[model samples]
Target chain A: MSIFEIIGAVFLLIGSIFLFLGGLGIFRMPDVYNRLQAGTKATTLGGMSLILGVGFLMVETNWAWMVKAIIIVIFIAFSNPISSHALARAMYKRKRYPIITSKDENMDAYREVNENEKKEEDA
Target chain B: MRKFLVILILAVLGFYLFEAFSGLGLGFPRFEHGVKDYYLDKTVSELHVANTVTSIVVSFRGFDTLGEVTVLFLAVSALGSVLYKRRHDVGSRSILFASSGIVRSGSKLLFPAIILLGVYIFIHGHLTPGGGFQGGAIIATGFLLMLLAYENFRVSHHVLSYVESLAGIIFVVIGLLGFIDGGTFLQNFLPSGILNELFSGGVIGIIYVMVGFKVAAELTGLIYSVLHEKD
Candidate 1:
């Protein structure tokens, strides 16, 4: 095997490991927030790595494969975080809090903002 | 008497269905010298559309496309009617929970790219795998991203409806013009230029563009109508 193929195989191995870990993370995480965090971050990197490994292996055929892989990676970079954020925000809005509270008093700033909006409307 | 009549009608239908279906050999369809062959043969040479699928969809079986578009239009209208409220009856609509600034800015950043991708897909429909429906769905998804991420981002009903109606009308007008000229609905009346060029597919390309526009507008309108229903 060529050096590039070896490198690609190694990347694939790493990506597979990360993907397996990501699945495990989602399974093991206690709550929605932690699961979302584990799922998005790990899967994003795992998928990117897997795709990039494929891209490297496919370099002999055409550079277009590499370009597509990069594009998907970029899309993952954009969409993964956004979707996770939206879901977390939705969950937070629905009052599904983390199992343990952080020691921050301003964590519930939404309540204050909502109250302020109500007060302004009232005024 | 009614039960007997129903049984007779069903028996007749079953016989007809069985007769029609049994003629064709059941395995992998051997498309030997039939409509598929004719479509495949004529699409490139006669229609000058590289994509046989595009030619069939936009030229040969274009009435089906019109009917499909009409069905989509009806569905959108149904959804709108179902979720509609008088502007005065309801308070101003906004996302109950405002998404973060990251989402807002990120969506704003990605919106134009998504739109450009959709437009590119539809415009290149005659040359590529994607056509009106796929592109329009992509465009609608982009609008959906905007709808989900922002508070005040509402697609105007008036403008969307106008665009949708105009697109549908133009598509029909094109079909009528072709029929009047060539004695066939959606006939290739215009000069079918050399295949694989931008303007090669003539009326086919135009129809697909119109279909894309109509679908995008209808889907966006459908999503918009639903978005407000949360209140």
Candidate 2:
């Protein structure tokens, strides 16, 4: 009934929708990299929205509870993406193939530069 | 046969729902009061931090937080040990990348801003709705951004472990202080000064700082375990 409650409900709804989108993206994306990008990004945003909604609701009723709810949202946002990046990097290092496009210039340059640097340091 | 089984299960679930909502009263029993009430009453005035929920987590329910932090620490350790062994066994070099200027440039620009925002969330946690865990995770994002921008970026191993251990030690020390003063771990042993001011909440700010450090250290370690390998 209250404006804050309405806003909270809308955020929760939007968050759920984003979560669903992330799930669909995971299934539908062409490759692991794309799927990670889609799923992780959406889930992070979705979770934040939902937690923020809960925080707002808590604030409306008990102002003291808002901080914790915010914490939950922030934690999710930070950890989810970092974990995703780690997984993505590991896959790349292990030579996992992406769905589309070949010719990875970045990887080649990185290897060359790193290897050269290592050799120099050793010498 | 599988389709039939699925339909049967759905039908049964629908029937159960129908029966319950039809006033048959087959739902689980509801408690009149909950554990939250006790926390709500005590935390509001005593914590002096606006967020009772945060107080419950880092103070009232600090034991659970300790376990969660330990779990993260354990995971990082497990990952590191396995990777260490694997790297020793296989001394192979393989390089791969996506030649996308757009993606690379975008990440370069976006990463620092995201990290700053994460720090903002943690620093203003007591006043606002965010806290340490969230903020630390954000700080980890900054590290992650660097990794994305440049693949060979290795976080200093010694620094990472020191930060992690230091955070763990701080957490324990705070808990021990609480035990010494209040006869309970994480109790508000210090004075709960005036409301709505930093240093007003006894031990709460200290707890948040600890949580932030611990979470940041653990997350950095986690990222390192998964991302970094001997080359």
Candidate 3:
């Protein structure tokens, strides 16, 4: 209806697109860790955008609602990364190895470094 | 044969549920005058509260709420008893997993903020959508975060029980005081102050505050007992 409304709608559209892509990534990603990475990044940005758009829409009408929206956005930003990290750490502790392809030489190098660290600890 | 019977029963149940749900109207009836009108019309003038839901929960249906709180208290006590361990064993129990320094520090920072938000929600229950139950749950969640991040985090059982008992006693005493003024149980005996003000709504706000404290302490204690159970 208005310029602010139009901007808010655009943000909502972008956020929905990111959320859709994040869902797609979850289904397409090779393993738990990769999926977690894709899912968390896209969803966090998507959710923040959506909340920000809501704040924009309410900016003129209600300052309190806008402030509440910003608080929610801040909470999501702080909690999302911590939760993702916890999930990844739990998976690692469980020894759930990611699917590795022969082309990924980096995995081998990472394993070698881990082994070296274990040996140092043992000695 | 067993599989076939199970499927048959589920199919019948699903069909019955679908039929029952479809028979119900989706919108409010145009020609019905019911208790809804009474509550909507009288809640503001009678209770001097802006929120009809609070008036209903704390004043009109106070007895039901008391029963519900009692049920919750019983359930939590049962859970605690089931999860109980020998007193000496609790001190020696080791945490199964330890979170990283980042998580621990972040949770420590966020914990107080979360509790403050929860308190705000409960305190503003009459003015807003949130109430004692929601706020108490949020407070419990803050405690849960502490439990998960810090192995040494502990809540004293004595403190929790005292808070829970005191809140419950205060709530009942307030209800009893209503009788002194020839009012029904939990009746608004005190002057319902001007609407929408923090001190308005008289007994409603006080009861909700008591409920908030009771629920927060109960849930936190329940969580603590469950978490401390011997593996």
Candidate achieving the largest DockQ? 3
Poorest 10 consecutive residues by lDDT, candidate 1 chain A: A109-118
| Winner by TM-score | 3
Best by lDDT: 1
TM-score of each candidate structure, all chains considered together? 0.81, 0.59, 0.91
Sort all candidates by TM-score, best to worst.
3, 1, 2
State each model's TM-score restricted to chain B.
0.84, 0.79, 0.93
- Candidate 2 lDDT, tens digit per residue, A1-123? 888888888999999999999999999988888899888999999989988888776677797677878766766765676667767766765667565356766754555654675599799
* CA lDDT, every model vs. true structure: 0.87, 0.76, 0.85
- Per-residue lDDT tens digits for candidate 2, residues B48-95, read 777876777777788998898888888888887766764347655534
Q: Which stretches of candidate 3 lie over 4 Å from their true place?
A: A102-123, B87-95
RMSD of each: 5.9, 9.6, 2.6
Clash-forming residue pairs, model 2: A64-B50, A64-B51, A64-B52, A67-B129
What does DockQ give for each predicted structure?
0.55, 0.07, 0.56
lDDT of model 2, residue B53: 68
Per-residue lDDT of model 1, residues A1-118, tens digit only: 7777777788788899989988999999999989988898888889889998998888777879989889878988888888888888788767687775788888777767766866
lDDT of 1: 0.87
Give residue B66's lDDT in candidate 2 (0 to 100): 87
